[model samples]
Target: MIGIATFLYIYGYKYICKAILTAKVMFMNNLNAPFPLLQSNKVKFISSFSFGFFVFVFLYIFQPFGINEVQFYKPLFIGGYALITFSCVAFSFFGLPLLFKNTFNPDKWTVKKAALYTSFIILIISVGNWYYTATIGQEVISLKHSFLKFIGITFSVGIFPTVIFLIFTEKTLRKVNESKAGNITKQIHTDLEIEEEKQENDIIPQIDFLADNNSIPLNQLNFLCIKSEGNYLEVFFFIDGKLNKSVIRYPLKKAFEQVNELNNIHHCHRSFIANFDQIEKVSGNARNYELHLRNLTFTIPVSRGFSKDLIAIYK
Candidate 1:
């Protein structure tokens, strides 16, 4: 009786650990952002049973002690083991969706509610285990002690793996937030350079408004920066800064050449060109800068290579 009880306890404990470690590896493989874990209920169930069976057979074959008791009806023992393993695996696999649903929509389960749910799940598993043993007519080696041992095995195998998964998910979220912050800083820097260029242009003396035979003033044209749908650039101009702008489609380099003639054009970033006269202030540290304009704010970043030029403009 003592040997049988010890065997069952050891077998159950090791099987539980194997199942949990397998689940953890599966969770890690499926960590593909926004979908942290896979939704394959069938795979999870199969994996659990396979892990349990593998661990059980490995332990039985490599019996550390000399307590090998040959029993008749060996097939019955194997079948019973398979049935128990499948039941445990299926229960865990089906329950996983509930965990994910709670994680994705936190509003569904408050801390208190989660605690209550977890307790209910544990209770169900414990009662189910007892009922299963009773129906099979298997007497526990030491009922009082084995019950506590079973609880320990279940927690170590199941709950510990879930906790580890939660930790990994939190780390992923932090990385995402850091990436967004970097993009925001870059945008702010671009807007600042545009404002600064506009201000510089305002200080320049107004040139004579030369009118062609059509009475269109060439010197009074307004400047605009237009981003193309893809790799094109278009510069728009409005005469007297009040008329509707006229667009000239050209490569960005060519547009830069035309703007250079006016003495106020600057490349804010690879993606933006700015008129410096509109710059209000350069805020934040040297690594990042904010450009404030009339009712708009943009970011301009000063790389180590461009820092000198940025400072020269401000000075």
Candidate 2:
């Protein structure tokens, strides 16, 4: 009986550990997944200030907190909501990311992340509102009794618009990029073909690509772009019409130095040096731009500093 019980306990413990490991993996996968978000500090600043104004306008118009019953100056009283909102938003979107750099990377941003972040901000807003209600309101109100009420009101008023607007905006931007990227990419392919024909006899320049204890030549490889990834550059190129990539131990800044003579190749992003000949189209407006490369799954982001340079080359 004792042997049978021991066997069952060990098996149960092993399965429980396995299940916990699986759950942990799933949770980490959601958090660490590389989700594309084109947001920057500029975007966050705009959103934070805009949300504060929205709160001001919302309170002024709605008067939801029985503010009509209060005898104090209404605009001055309601304006506090705006300040509270602005502070909370500025902290959540701007300050939190700065403090928690490892957790809030834009490259790995996810919808779940946005939703959770929005919810967290809203909760803080609710707490602020609750404190305001307790300290500033007319009657002697019991704090615990009305705390949940304030939370409910805050979430109802804020969450729907904030979360939905974010999701909608992301979806809309992606659609525009997808629609425009395909057309632009096709045109680029055509342009490359024409340019290839024009430069058929031109001598393709050869440059040395730094590698692990050696150098690699460029002319033989036909590399389309190079991406710097932690002491290695991921080099993309074509071989007999098939796309391929080669990883080399090199720095992107050095690669740009070597390829300066190549007019078609430009260091378009901090992490990327792109051959404009292989770029399908430049996406986004003057404020933000992205490069769609030929036969590549992801679009390369073009930082503001490099946008003018790329636009000049493309034109």
Candidate 3:
């Protein structure tokens, strides 16, 4: 009996801890079930053991199945039988998650998986119970006559309880998902309102450019510069702490007019427009007056005609 208890305690300790962590993340993350110590394996094992022990005690003391429950004679003495029964019940509850981990996996849960898991656990428990009764209880079993009797007894213990638990679990999960969806929608709306308020108070302007069916909104302060590429213009800007660009089919001369209202912007070259306030350094003279801008890796060419205007803005 001690050997059975020790074997159960050791193996149950190993399997239950890992099983609880996986089940909590997979099956209970958003649902927020009230088992706080599910995150700790030691606590989970103790909880399972204690609860299982109490339930077995209640059933044993009351003898719910009466004296001749299955073809087995009543244990004229239950002290030894009660201890073994408690060990089995505790082991069953502690190791249950390990048995059905795949069924509760967050990414792939379904009604089919739940039903399959229920069947597998029931089959295993039935076989286990048959062995326990044959070995430890006062039940004499013959290969010929007791096989069907064992099946009938084990089936009664395993099936209905599992089906009831599965039904309650599925209904609870459906309600949690619906509630979470409503909260997520409200959060998105609140974020959009906050962003609009910040844009209104910003010192630099926000530019809205129509880019193929999408509207790309660029903050003026983070707008590095733009360079004309034949019929297209490559617009550079800083967003999410990264330098990014978009190629749009707009004429450079026409693009300049759209942004001319901004005081710090200047047409520094026939091919380039510079945001003067963003310039970190200006080098070279007349022929090659290169302009280096903050947060930009490359320099912009300052043509002879635009050199004086760019230099004046830089100083």
Question: Which of the numbered candidates is closest to the native, going by highest TM-score?
Answer: 2
lDDT of each: 0.46, 0.71, 0.57
By descending TM-score, how would the candidates be arranged? Answer: 2, 3, 1
Off by over 4 Å in 3: 1-66, 69-104, 139-148, 196-315
TM-score for each of the candidates: 0.30, 0.51, 0.36
- Write model 2 residue lDDT over 1-315, tens digit each, in one string: 999999999999999999999999998877754344535667667777777787778877876667655555778777777778888988987778779897786544675776678788888988897787667643422224277787788777776558655765576556655655455656677777887787777777777666676565565336678888998888877767787788888778887887766667778778998777767676773134688777887888776566456545434
lDDT value, candidate 1, whole model: 0.46
**Cα RMSD (angstroms) for every candidate in the order listed:** 22.7, 7.3, 24.2
Looking at model 3, the pairs that clash are none
Q: Candidate 2, 70: how far from true, in Å?
A: 7.9
Count of backbone collisions within predicted model 2: 0
Q: Cα lDDT for residue 187, model 3?
A: 48
Give the per-residue lDDT of model 1 (tens digit) for 1-315: 999999999999999999999998876554421222323455556555764565356335642221133244434543454455456555655765576665534223233443444455445455554455445524322223255554554444346444543454445544543454455445546755665578665654343222121222223125433333346443333544453433333456655554556545576555555554444444433123434432232344433334345555654
Off by over 4 Å in 1: 1-104, 107-110, 137-153, 156-159, 172-315
